[model samples]
Target: MSFKNLPLLGTAEIIGALNLSPKQTAAAANLAHRVTQSAWRRRPPHKSGQTYEEFAAAVSACAWLTMFEVGALLILGRHHDARILTEASRSVHQAAHTGRRR
Candidate 1:
């Protein structure tokens, strides 16, 4: 599958969709912002290393990692929690595709 086609979900949307407490949502957003900013700053110039597809995949992986961390911190360890996460991911994927088509 092409990683470039994957959907990108904002941190706020993920936290809100998961029904996390306001405080938790804020914390997750802050963490995501920090990590994303750091990654961008450390990334090599556009001419070097990975292609755009690879870079996007790396970013998606980072977002997934952040989601997992936030979920763990929020005690989202039940089956229902997994279901919610899956649903959120699917929603984001659909939204991305819809946007692309427009």
Candidate 2:
């Protein structure tokens, strides 16, 4: 179960050594998939002159804004308050685009 052993083990072997329950394993897998997908999707263009740190910051900001929008939409439901979510999403989108163009 040591970090040093991780590199030598197959995925199943690692999972077994960790003794994760089925639900825990599934959740871990799902989280790993999400992280992988996000990394792939947000990877900066090669030779774009942007540092990895800058790209990561932008990606994190976008993800946070997206989650905020979703939460707002859910909380507002289908009521008139939904307009707030729409406006917030629009503002964030506009700001992101504006920042990128500078």
Q: Measured by TM-score, how close is model 1 to the native structure? A: 0.36
Q: What digit string (tens of lDDT, one per residue) describes model 1 on residues 26-77?
A: 5554554454545655787873576544554566654555454454344554
Q: Which candidate is the best by TM-score?
A: 1
Query: How does each model score on lDDT?
Result: 0.55, 0.47
For each candidate, C-alpha RMSD in Å? 10.0, 12.2
- Scored by lDDT, model 2 comes in at 0.47
Report clash pairs, candidate 1. none
Clashes counted in candidate 2 amount to 0
- Write candidate 2's Cα lDDT for 3-56 as tens digits: 211122344553565465665545444443344346656665782566544544
TM-score of each candidate structure, all chains considered together: 0.36, 0.35
Query: Where in model 2 is the C-alpha error above 4 Å?
Result: 1-9, 46-102
Lowest lDDT 10-mer window, candidate 2?
Answer: 1-10
Local error of candidate 2 at 62, Å? 28
